[model samples]
Target: MTSADTWIAAAKARADKRAKEGKVNIGTYTGNVKADDVIFSEVVKPSGHKAYDDAVKTIRSVQQAGFVVPPSAAAAEFTKAWQDAGNRVLLGERKPADAMKQAQQQAQQAIDEATQ
Candidate 1:
């Protein structure tokens, strides 16, 4: 089978296992993809901008590292930084590079704070 087919098979197997574990299938499964309860609960969409996306990814990584919770001060600050930069870019108030740089700096600050 092709790589794509193999992946789909693996996903199906996982879905079956989850089902056996009493996980409800919240969505239907198509031929190529499965839309189970767990899959449906995840936030998988991109923010359409690299800076915001990277900021979010950084925050998630830090949280996963057990440094902060979703509603923690550090997480809020990092999110605010990215959102501010994204809003500036969207409003044409700043260049994309400038916004990205600001967002990155803010993310770094958050990371430093969490690490310390």
Candidate 2:
């Protein structure tokens, strides 16, 4: 299934399970649903999962630091060119210098095209 479909299915499953349990307490600071059970707070106390907690901490830290950057078309083009060059080098198709020079040229061309 698609990403959105998978997400919806997972969410519906969670909701169904919670409803079956008869205690639904969904936490979300971004939501606007005013309710007695729904917690609208910045800190959604740890879930006890190390990996998930770490990811949440990192996301909250980045959000607090205002480090989130908007997507850039030029950066995407440059990254694709850079990855192609690295792949070519890895496959023994081109020398490192030649691959990098070509990558740079492609990225520069993308920038030029974007500006024009």
Candidate 3:
């Protein structure tokens, strides 16, 4: 299996475990937490790839910066940032490092703007 597949499997396992424990919403892992939070915390584990790791860290940082619950524009920005990075990487148009760097900057900017 590919690394992404491995990650997905691991996440599914975690989600199932969480569900069994009643920590997750029935039929979904996104329970009381934001989907990104679940993905960052439970889905994206360290895979020994520097770029992937950095991207995960960037995502976590943004999520921690109040991108969770929101009528906040920051949340929208975070979504865009994530989609841009993921799309670039998936399309092989950019290295994960490059994509994630841009995403990090955008997400941070959004947080700053939202807080201001």
Candidate 4:
């Protein structure tokens, strides 16, 4: 539901407040929070004509070449990723645990390979 978006945003705000109150690891979507209840966006490969990929290339290159944006260019990078992903975006009901598990698995795989 669209209301979830507002709630999640509020939760984030509260978590930030809690952090200011010396609370760490207590995020709005941390416990019992469903991913489906949060904003969701998936990037799909764009068609040939539209979409700028230089930013993505740059991000990968930055990761590979050890680079960091100087804040001034951060917005541009975010914008590019959004645009290049064919502008296909959705927001709603994203459970925190599922996302975290998938991310952890991917990271674990990468780490396993790196050590091997």
1 or 2, greater by lDDT:
2
User: Which segments of model 3 are wrong by more than 4 Å?
Assistant: 1-72
Tens digits of per-residue lDDT for model 3, 1-116: 33444545656777668657855322222222445455556554565667756765665556444534456659888889978999999999999999999999999899999989
> What lDDT score is found at residue 82 in candidate 1?
81
The local distance difference test score of each candidate is 0.60, 0.60, 0.66, 0.41
Between which residue pairs do clashes occur in model 1?
A: none
* Tens-place lDDT digits, model 4, residues 1-116: 34555656666566557556854322232222343234111111222322234443344334434534334323454434433333232232334555445545555554555457
Which ten-residue region of model 3 has the weakest summed lDDT? Answer: 24-33
Candidates ranked by lDDT: 3, 2, 1, 4
Number of backbone clashes in candidate 1 = 0
Worst 10 residues of 4 by lDDT: 39-48
Report the candidate with higher TM-score, 2 versus 4.
2
TM-score for candidate 2, please give it: 0.40
Pick by TM-score: 3 or 4, better one = 3
Tens digits of per-residue lDDT for model 2 on 12-87? Answer: 5565675578644242322122321133232144556677567755654454344322366687888888899999
**Regions of candidate 4 where Cα sits further than 4 Å from its true position:** 29-116
Better by lDDT, candidate 4 or 3: 3
